[model samples]
Target: MRYWPIPLLLVALFSAQGANAEPIGFVKTLQGGNAVIRALDDSERPAAIGGELNVGDTIRTDRRASLGLTLKDDTIMSVGPDTELTLEEYLFEPARGDLKLGSRLGRGTLQYVSGSIARLQPDAVSVKTPTGTIGVRGTQFVVRVGR
Candidate 1:
């Protein structure tokens, strides 16, 4: 019984730690219709405004839906309808100047605006599409991926 409690306690501790981990970004805005979100290790759900978006979360907009996301480093992304975007990975530790952002866009339009991560580490940001990867600088740009 003692050993069983110990294992249960450890599991609880780890589960609590993961639950307290910070999210990578948030859904700042949504327009037209609902957006679906597939979490890293969870099933798909409807995305709500102000919902936290974790790393590895995939977002999809329906026919006329649009979404705006604000990342931890303040990077802004606007996703158009009929688009699929995934937050592959993101690390933002400004204290040591360590910042990285990687994402993939599957079929739709996206408008990206640089943030502290890009301004501090210009080469650490990348957005991949079906064709190629985008090299992001400290600027805003638009990209579209085709089916």
Candidate 2:
């Protein structure tokens, strides 16, 4: 007799969850168990294959660790050991023609492969480092940052 309340409650719950729990990408490859994911609040978790990644998340790899991530728009990114890369922003909506990907590499090496976002809107993708910023133009590239 209370079916109406159940439906309304479910909608509210799912809406609230999706607003903040939507994962932007996932961890695809992990060479070692020394990788960590740091949240905006500074909390960290061990990086593992299939782990969810969100915007503003920082991925850190120890001396023996490496990680690979695949974004929602099929963009691929891999980082070598001792790397600190943060996903500064991500917005992908091809139908509406709104796409962007921004990342920051603090140190170490990173390999990036362009995705639909870069292909459709080449000017929307960028990678920032300590010394400079890189604009993606539907291609793959590697960058290293040193202290």
**What is the C-alpha local distance difference test score of each model?**
0.88, 0.90
Cα lDDT tens digits, model 2, 17-80, are: 6453467899999996589999888999999999999889999999999999999899999999
Residue pairs clashing in model 2 are none
Give the best candidate by lDDT: 2
What TM-score fits each model? 0.84, 0.86
Q: For each predicted model, how many residue pairs clash, with residues at least 3 apart or on different chains? A: 0, 0
lDDT per residue (tens digit) for residues 1-147 in model 1: 355676457657764675525777789999998899998897898999989898889999998999999997889999999999999978887775767999999889999998988999899999999999998986899999877
